[model samples]
Target: MIKIPGEKLIWMYKTMLKIRHFEDKIHRLFLEGNMPGTIHLYQGQEAVAAGVCANLERSDVITSTHRPHGHALAKGVAIKSLMAELFARSTGCCGGKGGSMHVGDPDVGMIPAIAIVGGGIPVATGIALAFKFQKSKRVAVSFFGDGACNEGSFHESLNMGAIWNLPVIYVCENNLYGASTSIRVAVKIRDLAERASSYGIPGVVVDGNEAISVYQATSKAVERARGGQGPTLIECKTYRRGGHSRSDACNYRDKEEEKMWLTRDPVVILRERLTKDGILTPEDSKQMEKEIEEELTQAIHFAENSPWPKPEEALEQVWA
Candidate 1:
Protein backbone atom coordinates (compact mmCIF):
# COMPACT_ATOMS: atom_id res chain seq x y z
CA MET A 1 0.00 0.00 0.00
CA ILE A 2 1.16 3.51 -0.70
CA LYS A 3 1.79 5.43 2.48
CA ILE A 4 0.46 8.97 2.26
CA PRO A 5 1.94 11.69 4.42
CA GLY A 6 -0.11 12.97 7.36
CA GLU A 7 -0.94 16.23 5.61
CA LYS A 8 -2.05 14.43 2.41
CA LEU A 9 -4.14 11.94 4.34
CA ILE A 10 -5.83 14.80 6.13
CA TRP A 11 -6.45 16.50 2.79
CA MET A 12 -8.00 13.32 1.37
CA TYR A 13 -10.32 13.02 4.35
CA LYS A 14 -11.33 16.65 4.00
CA THR A 15 -12.01 16.25 0.28
CA MET A 16 -14.05 13.10 0.76
CA LEU A 17 -16.05 14.66 3.56
CA LYS A 18 -16.69 17.73 1.46
CA ILE A 19 -18.03 15.64 -1.45
CA ARG A 20 -20.30 13.61 0.83
CA HIS A 21 -21.81 16.66 2.50
CA PHE A 22 -21.97 18.67 -0.69
CA GLU A 23 -23.88 15.95 -2.53
CA ASP A 24 -26.14 15.41 0.44
CA LYS A 25 -26.94 19.11 0.43
CA ILE A 26 -27.51 19.10 -3.32
CA HIS A 27 -29.98 16.27 -2.94
CA ARG A 28 -31.91 18.24 -0.35
CA LEU A 29 -31.68 21.46 -2.32
CA PHE A 30 -32.97 19.79 -5.48
CA LEU A 31 -35.81 18.12 -3.66
CA GLU A 32 -36.83 21.44 -2.10
CA GLY A 33 -36.78 23.18 -5.52
CA ASN A 34 -33.87 25.42 -4.56
CA MET A 35 -31.53 23.97 -7.17
CA PRO A 36 -32.00 23.26 -10.90
CA GLY A 37 -30.65 20.45 -13.06
CA THR A 38 -30.50 16.71 -12.37
CA ILE A 39 -27.78 15.29 -10.15
CA HIS A 40 -25.89 12.00 -9.92
CA LEU A 41 -24.53 11.93 -6.40
CA TYR A 42 -21.04 10.59 -5.65
CA GLN A 43 -22.04 9.46 -2.20
CA GLY A 44 -20.15 6.16 -2.01
CA GLN A 45 -17.27 6.20 -4.48
CA GLU A 46 -15.21 8.91 -2.81
CA ALA A 47 -12.11 6.77 -2.33
CA VAL A 48 -11.73 6.04 -6.06
CA ALA A 49 -11.48 9.70 -7.03
CA ALA A 50 -9.40 10.70 -4.02
CA GLY A 51 -6.90 7.89 -4.46
CA VAL A 52 -6.42 8.36 -8.21
CA CYS A 53 -6.05 12.14 -7.94
CA ALA A 54 -3.62 11.89 -5.02
CA ASN A 55 -0.96 10.72 -7.47
CA LEU A 56 -1.57 13.61 -9.87
CA GLU A 57 0.22 16.96 -9.90
CA ARG A 58 -1.59 20.27 -10.39
CA SER A 59 -0.45 20.42 -14.01
CA ASP A 60 -1.55 16.85 -14.62
CA VAL A 61 -5.06 16.46 -16.04
CA ILE A 62 -8.10 14.18 -15.51
CA THR A 63 -11.52 13.60 -17.05
CA SER A 64 -14.69 13.06 -15.07
CA THR A 65 -18.10 11.43 -15.55
CA HIS A 66 -21.70 12.54 -15.14
CA ARG A 67 -21.26 11.88 -11.40
CA PRO A 68 -18.15 14.01 -11.07
CA HIS A 69 -18.43 15.97 -7.82
CA GLY A 70 -15.91 13.71 -6.11
CA HIS A 71 -13.39 14.16 -8.93
CA ALA A 72 -13.99 17.93 -8.96
CA LEU A 73 -13.33 18.18 -5.23
CA ALA A 74 -10.32 15.86 -5.33
CA LYS A 75 -8.81 17.67 -8.35
CA GLY A 76 -8.82 20.91 -6.33
CA VAL A 77 -11.94 22.65 -7.69
CA ALA A 78 -13.09 25.23 -5.12
CA ILE A 79 -16.27 24.25 -3.28
CA LYS A 80 -17.84 27.68 -3.39
CA SER A 81 -17.39 27.92 -7.14
CA LEU A 82 -18.65 24.38 -7.61
CA MET A 83 -21.78 25.19 -5.64
CA ALA A 84 -22.19 28.43 -7.51
CA GLU A 85 -21.89 26.59 -10.80
CA LEU A 86 -24.56 24.18 -9.72
CA PHE A 87 -26.73 27.22 -9.05
CA ALA A 88 -26.17 28.55 -12.58
CA ARG A 89 -24.71 31.84 -11.36
CA SER A 90 -22.08 33.98 -13.09
CA THR A 91 -19.61 33.27 -10.28
CA GLY A 92 -19.94 29.56 -10.94
CA CYS A 93 -16.99 27.40 -12.03
CA CYS A 94 -18.16 27.50 -15.65
CA GLY A 95 -19.99 30.83 -15.50
CA GLY A 96 -22.96 28.51 -14.88
CA LYS A 97 -22.68 26.81 -18.25
CA GLY A 98 -21.32 23.41 -17.11
CA GLY A 99 -23.65 22.78 -14.18
CA SER A 100 -23.38 19.54 -12.17
CA MET A 101 -22.09 17.15 -14.80
CA HIS A 102 -19.53 19.60 -16.17
CA VAL A 103 -18.26 21.20 -12.94
CA GLY A 104 -14.52 21.85 -13.34
CA ASP A 105 -11.82 24.52 -13.19
CA PRO A 106 -8.96 24.14 -15.66
CA ASP A 107 -6.93 26.59 -13.62
CA VAL A 108 -6.85 23.88 -10.97
CA GLY A 109 -5.78 21.14 -13.44
CA MET A 110 -9.30 19.78 -14.08
CA ILE A 111 -10.90 20.22 -17.45
CA PRO A 112 -14.69 20.53 -17.45
CA ALA A 113 -15.90 16.96 -16.87
CA ILE A 114 -17.24 15.13 -19.92
CA ALA A 115 -20.80 14.06 -19.20
CA ILE A 116 -20.89 11.48 -21.97
CA VAL A 117 -20.18 8.00 -20.60
CA GLY A 118 -16.91 7.30 -22.46
CA GLY A 119 -16.41 10.62 -24.25
CA GLY A 120 -13.48 11.75 -22.10
CA ILE A 121 -11.41 8.65 -22.78
CA PRO A 122 -10.27 9.99 -26.14
CA VAL A 123 -10.11 13.51 -24.82
CA ALA A 124 -7.70 12.33 -22.16
CA THR A 125 -5.70 10.70 -24.89
CA GLY A 126 -5.55 14.02 -26.75
CA ILE A 127 -4.38 15.84 -23.62
CA ALA A 128 -1.63 13.24 -23.10
CA LEU A 129 -0.76 13.58 -26.76
CA ALA A 130 -0.25 17.30 -26.24
CA PHE A 131 1.95 16.63 -23.21
CA LYS A 132 4.05 14.13 -25.16
CA PHE A 133 4.52 16.46 -28.14
CA GLN A 134 5.69 19.20 -25.79
CA LYS A 135 8.03 16.70 -24.07
CA SER A 136 6.29 17.42 -20.79
CA LYS A 137 5.76 14.78 -18.09
CA ARG A 138 2.18 15.56 -17.13
CA VAL A 139 -0.19 12.58 -16.95
CA ALA A 140 -3.86 12.61 -17.94
CA VAL A 141 -6.24 10.31 -16.11
CA SER A 142 -9.68 9.36 -17.39
CA PHE A 143 -12.55 8.37 -15.04
CA PHE A 144 -15.29 6.23 -16.57
CA GLY A 145 -17.79 3.66 -15.34
CA ASP A 146 -18.08 -0.07 -16.12
CA GLY A 147 -20.60 0.66 -18.89
CA ALA A 148 -18.13 2.84 -20.75
CA CYS A 149 -15.91 -0.19 -21.31
CA ASN A 150 -18.31 -1.37 -23.99
CA GLU A 151 -18.13 1.93 -25.85
CA GLY A 152 -16.02 2.21 -29.01
CA SER A 153 -14.15 5.18 -27.59
CA PHE A 154 -12.82 3.01 -24.80
CA HIS A 155 -11.31 0.60 -27.28
CA GLU A 156 -9.96 3.31 -29.58
CA SER A 157 -8.42 5.32 -26.75
CA LEU A 158 -6.67 2.26 -25.35
CA ASN A 159 -5.31 1.28 -28.76
CA MET A 160 -3.96 4.78 -29.42
CA GLY A 161 -2.51 5.18 -25.95
CA ALA A 162 -0.68 1.88 -26.27
CA ILE A 163 0.62 2.50 -29.78
CA TRP A 164 1.89 6.00 -28.98
CA ASN A 165 2.60 5.28 -25.33
CA LEU A 166 0.64 8.31 -24.16
CA PRO A 167 0.90 9.31 -20.53
CA VAL A 168 -2.65 8.37 -19.56
CA ILE A 169 -4.36 6.23 -16.95
CA TYR A 170 -7.82 4.81 -17.55
CA VAL A 171 -9.65 4.37 -14.23
CA CYS A 172 -12.80 2.28 -14.41
CA GLU A 173 -14.91 2.72 -11.29
CA ASN A 174 -16.79 -0.56 -11.74
CA ASN A 175 -19.61 0.30 -9.40
CA LEU A 176 -21.49 -2.93 -10.32
CA TYR A 177 -24.24 -1.08 -12.13
CA GLY A 178 -24.22 1.27 -15.09
CA ALA A 179 -27.27 3.45 -14.88
CA SER A 180 -29.99 0.87 -14.05
CA THR A 181 -28.33 -2.11 -15.73
CA SER A 182 -26.11 -4.54 -13.88
CA ILE A 183 -22.66 -5.44 -15.26
CA ARG A 184 -23.60 -9.11 -15.16
CA VAL A 185 -26.33 -8.49 -17.74
CA ALA A 186 -24.23 -6.06 -19.84
CA VAL A 187 -20.99 -7.96 -20.45
CA LYS A 188 -19.50 -11.42 -20.14
CA ILE A 189 -16.10 -10.36 -18.78
CA ARG A 190 -16.02 -9.86 -15.01
CA ASP A 191 -12.72 -7.95 -15.02
CA LEU A 192 -12.63 -4.80 -17.16
CA ALA A 193 -8.88 -4.51 -16.52
CA GLU A 194 -8.32 -7.63 -18.57
CA ARG A 195 -9.26 -5.64 -21.66
CA ALA A 196 -6.01 -3.69 -21.19
CA SER A 197 -3.91 -6.65 -22.30
CA SER A 198 -5.61 -6.59 -25.71
CA TYR A 199 -3.93 -3.22 -26.26
CA GLY A 200 -0.57 -4.31 -24.83
CA ILE A 201 -0.89 -2.19 -21.67
CA PRO A 202 -0.82 -3.17 -18.02
CA GLY A 203 -4.15 -3.69 -16.24
CA VAL A 204 -4.56 -3.68 -12.47
CA VAL A 205 -7.55 -4.40 -10.27
CA VAL A 206 -7.69 -2.70 -6.88
CA ASP A 207 -9.98 -2.51 -3.91
CA GLY A 208 -11.69 0.82 -4.62
CA ASN A 209 -13.11 1.11 -1.10
CA GLU A 210 -9.61 1.01 0.37
CA ALA A 211 -7.95 4.38 -0.23
CA ILE A 212 -4.45 3.03 0.37
CA SER A 213 -4.77 0.35 -2.28
CA VAL A 214 -6.21 2.71 -4.89
CA TYR A 215 -3.48 5.26 -4.13
CA GLN A 216 -0.75 2.65 -4.49
CA ALA A 217 -2.02 1.36 -7.82
CA THR A 218 -2.38 4.89 -9.18
CA SER A 219 1.14 5.84 -8.02
CA LYS A 220 2.74 3.11 -10.11
CA ALA A 221 0.65 4.00 -13.19
CA VAL A 222 1.52 7.69 -12.83
CA GLU A 223 5.22 6.88 -12.47
CA ARG A 224 5.29 4.58 -15.47
CA ALA A 225 3.57 7.22 -17.62
CA ARG A 226 6.01 9.91 -16.48
CA GLY A 227 8.95 7.66 -17.34
CA GLY A 228 7.64 7.37 -20.94
CA GLN A 229 6.48 3.78 -20.51
CA GLY A 230 2.84 4.32 -21.60
CA PRO A 231 -0.75 4.15 -20.40
CA THR A 232 -2.27 1.72 -17.88
CA LEU A 233 -5.83 0.57 -17.11
CA ILE A 234 -6.92 0.40 -13.47
CA GLU A 235 -10.27 -1.25 -12.72
CA CYS A 236 -11.40 -0.18 -9.26
CA LYS A 237 -13.87 -2.62 -7.73
CA THR A 238 -16.54 -0.53 -5.98
CA TYR A 239 -20.31 -0.04 -5.62
CA ARG A 240 -22.40 3.09 -5.99
CA ARG A 241 -24.69 3.50 -3.01
CA GLY A 242 -27.23 5.57 -4.89
CA GLY A 243 -29.07 5.54 -8.19
CA HIS A 244 -27.44 6.45 -11.50
CA SER A 245 -29.21 9.80 -11.40
CA ARG A 246 -31.90 11.52 -9.39
CA SER A 247 -34.51 10.02 -11.70
CA ASP A 248 -33.30 6.46 -11.17
CA ALA A 249 -34.99 4.24 -8.62
CA CYS A 250 -32.42 1.45 -8.98
CA ASN A 251 -35.25 -1.09 -8.82
CA TYR A 252 -32.92 -3.44 -10.67
CA ARG A 253 -30.50 -3.83 -7.75
CA ASP A 254 -31.20 -6.57 -5.27
CA LYS A 255 -31.55 -5.72 -1.60
CA GLU A 256 -28.69 -8.07 -0.77
CA GLU A 257 -26.34 -6.25 -3.15
CA GLU A 258 -27.07 -2.92 -1.53
CA LYS A 259 -26.58 -4.37 1.94
CA MET A 260 -23.26 -5.91 0.93
CA TRP A 261 -21.92 -2.59 -0.32
CA LEU A 262 -23.14 -0.63 2.68
CA THR A 263 -21.03 -2.95 4.80
CA ARG A 264 -17.93 -1.73 2.95
CA ASP A 265 -18.62 1.97 3.22
CA PRO A 266 -15.53 3.86 2.03
CA VAL A 267 -15.64 6.60 4.64
CA VAL A 268 -16.05 4.12 7.49
CA ILE A 269 -13.16 2.06 6.17
CA LEU A 270 -10.95 5.15 5.89
CA ARG A 271 -11.67 6.26 9.42
CA GLU A 272 -10.96 2.76 10.73
CA ARG A 273 -7.70 2.51 8.80
CA LEU A 274 -6.48 5.91 9.92
CA THR A 275 -7.20 5.15 13.55
CA LYS A 276 -5.62 1.74 13.35
CA ASP A 277 -2.47 3.10 11.69
CA GLY A 278 -2.07 5.76 14.37
CA ILE A 279 -2.24 8.45 11.71
CA LEU A 280 -5.40 9.90 13.21
CA THR A 281 -7.66 9.56 16.22
CA PRO A 282 -11.41 8.92 16.05
CA GLU A 283 -11.89 12.38 17.52
CA ASP A 284 -9.77 13.84 14.77
CA SER A 285 -11.96 12.20 12.15
CA LYS A 286 -15.10 13.53 13.77
CA GLN A 287 -13.63 17.02 13.91
CA MET A 288 -12.77 16.84 10.21
CA GLU A 289 -16.33 15.87 9.32
CA LYS A 290 -17.70 18.69 11.46
CA GLU A 291 -15.43 21.26 9.80
CA ILE A 292 -16.36 20.05 6.32
CA GLU A 293 -20.07 20.27 7.10
CA GLU A 294 -19.68 23.85 8.28
CA GLU A 295 -17.80 24.78 5.10
CA LEU A 296 -20.51 23.18 2.96
CA THR A 297 -23.15 25.21 4.77
CA GLN A 298 -21.22 28.31 3.80
CA ALA A 299 -21.08 27.13 0.20
CA ILE A 300 -24.86 26.62 0.17
CA HIS A 301 -25.44 30.19 1.30
CA PHE A 302 -23.02 31.51 -1.30
CA ALA A 303 -24.80 29.64 -4.06
CA GLU A 304 -28.24 30.60 -2.81
CA ASN A 305 -27.57 34.31 -2.78
CA SER A 306 -25.64 34.43 -6.04
CA PRO A 307 -27.48 35.96 -8.99
CA TRP A 308 -28.31 33.88 -12.04
CA PRO A 309 -26.63 34.69 -15.33
CA LYS A 310 -28.47 37.26 -17.49
CA PRO A 311 -30.52 35.83 -20.38
CA GLU A 312 -28.50 37.72 -23.01
CA GLU A 313 -25.28 36.14 -21.70
CA ALA A 314 -25.87 33.04 -23.81
CA LEU A 315 -24.79 34.98 -26.92
CA GLU A 316 -21.47 35.96 -25.33
CA GLN A 317 -19.65 32.64 -24.75
CA VAL A 318 -20.91 30.91 -27.87
CA TRP A 319 -18.86 30.98 -31.09
CA ALA A 320 -21.73 31.13 -33.55
Candidate 2:
Protein backbone atom coordinates (compact mmCIF):
# COMPACT_ATOMS: atom_id res chain seq x y z
CA MET A 1 0.00 0.00 0.00
CA ILE A 2 1.30 3.46 -0.87
CA LYS A 3 1.54 6.01 1.87
CA ILE A 4 -1.49 8.31 1.71
CA PRO A 5 -2.55 11.17 3.93
CA GLY A 6 -5.22 10.28 6.49
CA GLU A 7 -7.44 13.04 5.14
CA LYS A 8 -7.15 11.74 1.57
CA LEU A 9 -7.88 8.19 2.70
CA ILE A 10 -10.99 9.42 4.45
CA TRP A 11 -12.04 11.42 1.43
CA MET A 12 -11.69 8.40 -0.83
CA TYR A 13 -13.81 6.35 1.53
CA LYS A 14 -16.47 9.04 1.64
CA THR A 15 -16.51 9.38 -2.13
CA MET A 16 -16.91 5.62 -2.52
CA LEU A 17 -19.74 5.69 -0.01
CA LYS A 18 -21.48 8.48 -1.87
CA ILE A 19 -21.23 6.65 -5.19
CA ARG A 20 -22.51 3.41 -3.65
CA HIS A 21 -25.45 5.08 -1.92
CA PHE A 22 -26.29 7.16 -4.97
CA GLU A 23 -26.31 4.13 -7.21
CA ASP A 24 -28.40 2.17 -4.72
CA LYS A 25 -30.96 4.97 -4.62
CA ILE A 26 -31.01 5.23 -8.40
CA HIS A 27 -31.56 1.48 -8.70
CA ARG A 28 -34.58 1.69 -6.43
CA LEU A 29 -35.95 4.74 -8.26
CA PHE A 30 -35.57 3.10 -11.65
CA LEU A 31 -37.26 -0.07 -10.43
CA GLU A 32 -40.14 1.98 -9.00
CA GLY A 33 -40.44 4.09 -12.21
CA ASN A 34 -39.36 7.31 -10.55
CA MET A 35 -36.45 7.92 -12.90
CA PRO A 36 -36.97 8.81 -16.58
CA GLY A 37 -34.47 6.62 -18.44
CA THR A 38 -32.27 3.56 -18.35
CA ILE A 39 -29.23 3.73 -16.14
CA HIS A 40 -25.86 1.91 -16.07
CA LEU A 41 -25.10 2.06 -12.39
CA TYR A 42 -21.56 2.54 -11.01
CA GLN A 43 -21.83 0.48 -7.87
CA GLY A 44 -18.59 -1.50 -7.59
CA GLN A 45 -16.17 0.73 -9.46
CA GLU A 46 -16.15 3.73 -7.15
CA ALA A 47 -12.47 3.40 -6.25
CA VAL A 48 -11.34 3.86 -9.82
CA ALA A 49 -13.13 7.20 -10.16
CA ALA A 50 -12.23 8.48 -6.71
CA GLY A 51 -8.56 7.55 -6.96
CA VAL A 52 -8.00 8.84 -10.50
CA CYS A 53 -9.85 12.13 -10.02
CA ALA A 54 -8.18 12.80 -6.69
CA ASN A 55 -4.87 13.15 -8.52
CA LEU A 56 -6.24 15.68 -11.00
CA GLU A 57 -6.46 19.45 -10.75
CA ARG A 58 -9.68 21.45 -11.10
CA SER A 59 -8.59 22.59 -14.56
CA ASP A 60 -7.97 19.05 -15.71
CA VAL A 61 -10.84 17.60 -17.77
CA ILE A 62 -12.35 14.13 -18.11
CA THR A 63 -14.57 12.37 -20.62
CA SER A 64 -16.77 9.60 -19.24
CA THR A 65 -18.76 6.72 -20.67
CA HIS A 66 -22.32 5.54 -19.95
CA ARG A 67 -21.32 4.81 -16.36
CA PRO A 68 -20.63 8.43 -15.38
CA HIS A 69 -22.30 9.26 -12.11
CA GLY A 70 -19.26 8.19 -10.13
CA HIS A 71 -17.00 10.19 -12.42
CA ALA A 72 -19.26 13.24 -12.20
CA LEU A 73 -19.40 13.13 -8.43
CA ALA A 74 -15.68 12.50 -8.10
CA LYS A 75 -15.00 15.46 -10.37
CA GLY A 76 -17.03 17.71 -8.07
CA VAL A 77 -20.33 17.91 -9.95
CA ALA A 78 -23.18 18.99 -7.66
CA ILE A 79 -25.32 16.13 -6.31
CA LYS A 80 -28.48 18.21 -6.70
CA SER A 81 -27.86 18.84 -10.40
CA LEU A 82 -27.19 15.15 -11.06
CA MET A 83 -30.33 14.11 -9.19
CA ALA A 84 -32.33 16.71 -11.09
CA GLU A 85 -31.04 15.45 -14.40
CA LEU A 86 -32.02 11.89 -13.54
CA PHE A 87 -35.43 13.15 -12.46
CA ALA A 88 -35.77 15.12 -15.70
CA ARG A 89 -36.19 18.45 -13.97
CA SER A 90 -35.42 21.86 -15.48
CA THR A 91 -32.74 22.74 -12.94
CA GLY A 92 -30.52 19.83 -13.93
CA CYS A 93 -26.97 20.38 -15.11
CA CYS A 94 -28.20 19.96 -18.69
CA GLY A 95 -31.58 21.56 -18.07
CA GLY A 96 -33.08 18.06 -17.85
CA LYS A 97 -31.87 17.34 -21.39
CA GLY A 98 -29.14 14.79 -20.61
CA GLY A 99 -30.59 11.84 -18.78
CA SER A 100 -28.74 9.11 -16.89
CA MET A 101 -26.19 8.23 -19.57
CA HIS A 102 -25.30 11.82 -20.46
CA VAL A 103 -24.76 13.30 -17.02
CA GLY A 104 -21.90 15.77 -16.64
CA ASP A 105 -20.99 19.30 -15.49
CA PRO A 106 -18.31 21.02 -17.58
CA ASP A 107 -17.97 23.73 -14.98
CA VAL A 108 -16.53 21.01 -12.78
CA GLY A 109 -14.31 19.69 -15.59
CA MET A 110 -16.48 16.75 -16.78
CA ILE A 111 -17.69 16.56 -20.35
CA PRO A 112 -21.22 15.23 -20.77
CA ALA A 113 -20.72 11.45 -20.98
CA ILE A 114 -20.78 9.87 -24.44
CA ALA A 115 -22.78 6.63 -24.47
CA ILE A 116 -21.03 5.13 -27.50
CA VAL A 117 -18.41 2.57 -26.56
CA GLY A 118 -15.36 4.51 -27.71
CA GLY A 119 -16.93 7.86 -28.58
CA GLY A 120 -15.16 9.84 -25.87
CA ILE A 121 -11.69 8.69 -26.91
CA PRO A 122 -11.29 11.08 -29.82
CA VAL A 123 -12.98 13.88 -27.91
CA ALA A 124 -10.58 13.50 -25.01
CA THR A 125 -7.67 13.38 -27.44
CA GLY A 126 -8.89 16.62 -28.97
CA ILE A 127 -9.13 18.22 -25.54
CA ALA A 128 -5.58 17.12 -24.80
CA LEU A 129 -4.46 18.57 -28.12
CA ALA A 130 -6.03 21.88 -27.15
CA PHE A 131 -4.23 21.82 -23.84
CA LYS A 132 -0.96 21.26 -25.63
CA PHE A 133 -1.70 24.06 -28.09
CA GLN A 134 -2.38 26.46 -25.25
CA LYS A 135 0.80 25.24 -23.48
CA SER A 136 -1.23 24.40 -20.42
CA LYS A 137 -0.33 21.70 -17.95
CA ARG A 138 -3.89 20.50 -17.81
CA VAL A 139 -4.55 16.84 -18.62
CA ALA A 140 -7.56 15.15 -20.20
CA VAL A 141 -8.73 11.73 -19.06
CA SER A 142 -10.93 9.32 -20.98
CA PHE A 143 -12.75 6.67 -18.93
CA PHE A 144 -13.94 3.73 -20.95
CA GLY A 145 -14.69 0.03 -20.65
CA ASP A 146 -12.58 -2.87 -21.91
CA GLY A 147 -14.96 -3.30 -24.86
CA ALA A 148 -13.79 0.05 -26.24
CA CYS A 149 -10.23 -1.23 -26.47
CA ASN A 150 -11.20 -2.92 -29.73
CA GLU A 151 -12.76 0.22 -31.21
CA GLY A 152 -11.04 2.05 -34.05
CA SER A 153 -11.48 5.38 -32.30
CA PHE A 154 -9.59 4.04 -29.33
CA HIS A 155 -6.64 3.08 -31.54
CA GLU A 156 -6.75 6.26 -33.61
CA SER A 157 -6.98 8.56 -30.61
CA LEU A 158 -4.15 6.75 -28.85
CA ASN A 159 -2.01 6.99 -31.96
CA MET A 160 -2.70 10.72 -32.29
CA GLY A 161 -2.12 11.32 -28.60
CA ALA A 162 1.16 9.40 -28.71
CA ILE A 163 2.52 11.09 -31.85
CA TRP A 164 1.63 14.55 -30.58
CA ASN A 165 2.73 13.79 -27.01
CA LEU A 166 -0.60 15.12 -25.71
CA PRO A 167 -1.22 15.24 -22.00
CA VAL A 168 -3.83 12.52 -21.69
CA ILE A 169 -4.56 9.49 -19.57
CA TYR A 170 -6.63 6.67 -20.98
CA VAL A 171 -8.20 4.78 -18.11
CA CYS A 172 -9.65 1.38 -18.90
CA GLU A 173 -12.00 0.31 -16.13
CA ASN A 174 -11.87 -3.35 -17.07
CA ASN A 175 -14.72 -4.66 -14.98
CA LEU A 176 -14.06 -8.29 -16.07
CA TYR A 177 -16.99 -8.17 -18.48
CA GLY A 178 -18.04 -5.57 -21.02
CA ALA A 179 -21.82 -5.65 -20.93
CA SER A 180 -22.03 -9.41 -20.23
CA THR A 181 -19.29 -10.34 -22.69
CA SER A 182 -16.27 -11.50 -20.78
CA ILE A 183 -12.91 -9.97 -21.66
CA ARG A 184 -11.61 -13.51 -22.10
CA VAL A 185 -13.99 -13.92 -25.01
CA ALA A 186 -13.43 -10.42 -26.40
CA VAL A 187 -9.67 -9.92 -26.42
CA LYS A 188 -6.68 -12.15 -26.91
CA ILE A 189 -4.39 -10.43 -24.48
CA ARG A 190 -4.80 -10.80 -20.73
CA ASP A 191 -3.92 -7.18 -19.92
CA LEU A 192 -5.42 -4.32 -21.92
CA ALA A 193 -2.62 -1.97 -20.90
CA GLU A 194 -0.27 -4.02 -23.07
CA ARG A 195 -1.87 -2.30 -26.06
CA ALA A 196 -0.25 0.99 -25.07
CA SER A 197 3.14 -0.23 -26.25
CA SER A 198 1.92 -0.07 -29.84
CA TYR A 199 1.52 3.70 -29.36
CA GLY A 200 4.95 3.95 -27.68
CA ILE A 201 3.48 5.13 -24.37
CA PRO A 202 3.69 3.65 -20.90
CA GLY A 203 1.23 0.95 -19.92
CA VAL A 204 0.22 0.16 -16.35
CA VAL A 205 -2.07 -2.31 -14.65
CA VAL A 206 -3.25 -1.75 -11.08
CA ASP A 207 -5.59 -3.23 -8.50
CA GLY A 208 -8.51 -0.93 -9.08
CA ASN A 209 -10.27 -2.19 -5.96
CA GLU A 210 -7.51 -0.67 -3.85
CA ALA A 211 -7.96 3.07 -3.73
CA ILE A 212 -4.39 3.80 -2.65
CA SER A 213 -3.01 1.62 -5.41
CA VAL A 214 -5.09 3.42 -8.02
CA TYR A 215 -4.13 6.81 -6.62
CA GLN A 216 -0.44 5.89 -6.85
CA ALA A 217 -0.68 4.73 -10.45
CA THR A 218 -2.68 7.84 -11.43
CA SER A 219 -0.25 10.08 -9.61
CA LYS A 220 2.64 8.74 -11.66
CA ALA A 221 0.65 8.97 -14.89
CA VAL A 222 -0.46 12.53 -14.13
CA GLU A 223 3.08 13.59 -13.32
CA ARG A 224 4.35 12.15 -16.57
CA ALA A 225 1.55 13.83 -18.50
CA ARG A 226 2.07 17.23 -16.85
CA GLY A 227 5.79 16.98 -17.59
CA GLY A 228 4.93 16.56 -21.30
CA GLN A 229 6.05 12.95 -21.52
CA GLY A 230 2.90 11.96 -23.41
CA PRO A 231 -0.08 9.68 -22.71
CA THR A 232 -0.46 6.57 -20.58
CA LEU A 233 -2.88 3.63 -20.75
CA ILE A 234 -3.84 2.45 -17.30
CA GLU A 235 -5.86 -0.75 -17.06
CA CYS A 236 -7.82 -0.88 -13.80
CA LYS A 237 -8.71 -4.47 -12.91
CA THR A 238 -12.09 -4.04 -11.26
CA TYR A 239 -15.57 -5.56 -11.30
CA ARG A 240 -19.14 -4.31 -11.45
CA ARG A 241 -21.41 -5.83 -8.86
CA GLY A 242 -24.61 -5.13 -10.75
CA GLY A 243 -25.77 -5.91 -14.25
CA HIS A 244 -24.59 -3.89 -17.22
CA SER A 245 -27.85 -1.94 -17.22
CA ARG A 246 -31.14 -1.83 -15.39
CA SER A 247 -32.71 -4.51 -17.58
CA ASP A 248 -29.82 -6.93 -17.40
CA ALA A 249 -30.00 -9.75 -14.88
CA CYS A 250 -26.38 -10.76 -15.69
CA ASN A 251 -27.47 -14.31 -16.47
CA TYR A 252 -24.36 -14.75 -18.58
CA ARG A 253 -22.08 -14.33 -15.57
CA ASP A 254 -21.16 -17.30 -13.45
CA LYS A 255 -22.41 -17.37 -9.89
CA GLU A 256 -18.96 -18.13 -8.44
CA GLU A 257 -17.35 -15.26 -10.34
CA GLU A 258 -19.96 -12.86 -9.03
CA LYS A 259 -19.51 -14.14 -5.53
CA MET A 260 -15.71 -13.80 -5.74
CA TRP A 261 -15.84 -10.19 -6.93
CA LEU A 262 -18.43 -9.34 -4.34
CA THR A 263 -15.99 -10.47 -1.70
CA ARG A 264 -13.55 -7.90 -3.03
CA ASP A 265 -16.06 -5.10 -3.13
CA PRO A 266 -14.11 -1.84 -3.35
CA VAL A 267 -16.21 0.02 -0.82
CA VAL A 268 -15.99 -2.72 1.78
CA ILE A 269 -12.25 -3.18 1.20
CA LEU A 270 -11.52 0.52 1.66
CA ARG A 271 -13.72 0.94 4.71
CA GLU A 272 -12.10 -2.06 6.38
CA ARG A 273 -8.63 -0.75 5.61
CA LEU A 274 -9.51 2.66 6.99
CA THR A 275 -10.92 1.23 10.17
CA LYS A 276 -7.98 -1.09 10.66
CA ASP A 277 -5.57 1.78 10.14
CA GLY A 278 -7.33 3.83 12.80
CA ILE A 279 -8.07 6.59 10.30
CA LEU A 280 -11.77 5.82 10.71
CA THR A 281 -13.94 4.17 13.31
CA PRO A 282 -17.25 2.32 13.23
CA GLU A 283 -19.06 5.36 14.60
CA ASP A 284 -17.39 7.63 12.05
CA SER A 285 -18.37 5.30 9.22
CA LYS A 286 -21.97 5.27 10.45
CA GLN A 287 -21.96 9.05 10.67
CA MET A 288 -20.61 9.35 7.13
CA GLU A 289 -23.34 7.04 5.86
CA LYS A 290 -25.95 9.05 7.70
CA GLU A 291 -24.65 12.32 6.22
CA ILE A 292 -24.61 10.86 2.70
CA GLU A 293 -28.18 9.66 3.14
CA GLU A 294 -29.26 13.12 4.31
CA GLU A 295 -27.54 14.72 1.32
CA LEU A 296 -29.22 12.28 -1.05
CA THR A 297 -32.59 13.03 0.54
CA GLN A 298 -32.05 16.76 0.05
CA ALA A 299 -31.05 16.22 -3.58
CA ILE A 300 -34.12 14.07 -4.21
CA HIS A 301 -36.38 16.74 -2.70
CA PHE A 302 -34.78 19.41 -4.85
CA ALA A 303 -35.27 17.31 -7.96
CA GLU A 304 -38.90 16.41 -7.15
CA ASN A 305 -39.86 20.02 -6.34
CA SER A 306 -38.22 21.42 -9.48
CA PRO A 307 -40.39 21.86 -12.56
CA TRP A 308 -39.90 20.00 -15.82
CA PRO A 309 -38.37 21.75 -18.83
CA LYS A 310 -40.95 23.30 -21.13
CA PRO A 311 -41.54 21.46 -24.40
CA GLU A 312 -40.38 24.51 -26.37
CA GLU A 313 -36.93 24.27 -24.70
CA ALA A 314 -36.24 20.83 -26.08
CA LEU A 315 -34.64 22.10 -29.30
CA GLU A 316 -32.97 25.12 -27.72
CA GLN A 317 -29.64 23.44 -27.02
CA VAL A 318 -29.75 21.11 -30.02
CA TRP A 319 -27.23 21.89 -32.73
CA ALA A 320 -27.54 20.31 -36.11
Best by lDDT: 2
- Residue 128 error for model 1, in Å? 0.1
Candidate 2 runs further than 4 Å off: none
How do the predictions measure up, each by TM-score? 0.97, 0.98
Candidate 1 ranges beyond 4 A from true positions: none
lDDT of 1 at 191: 92
Per-residue lDDT of 11 in model 2: 89
Question: Model 2 lDDT vs. the true structure?
Answer: 0.94
Model 1 Cα shift for residue 9 (angstroms)? 2.1
* Candidate topping TM-score: 2
**Each candidate's lDDT (Cα)?**
0.90, 0.94
lDDT of 1 by residue, 207-244 (tens): 99987789899999999999999999999999988888
Native RMSD of candidate 1 (Å):
1.1
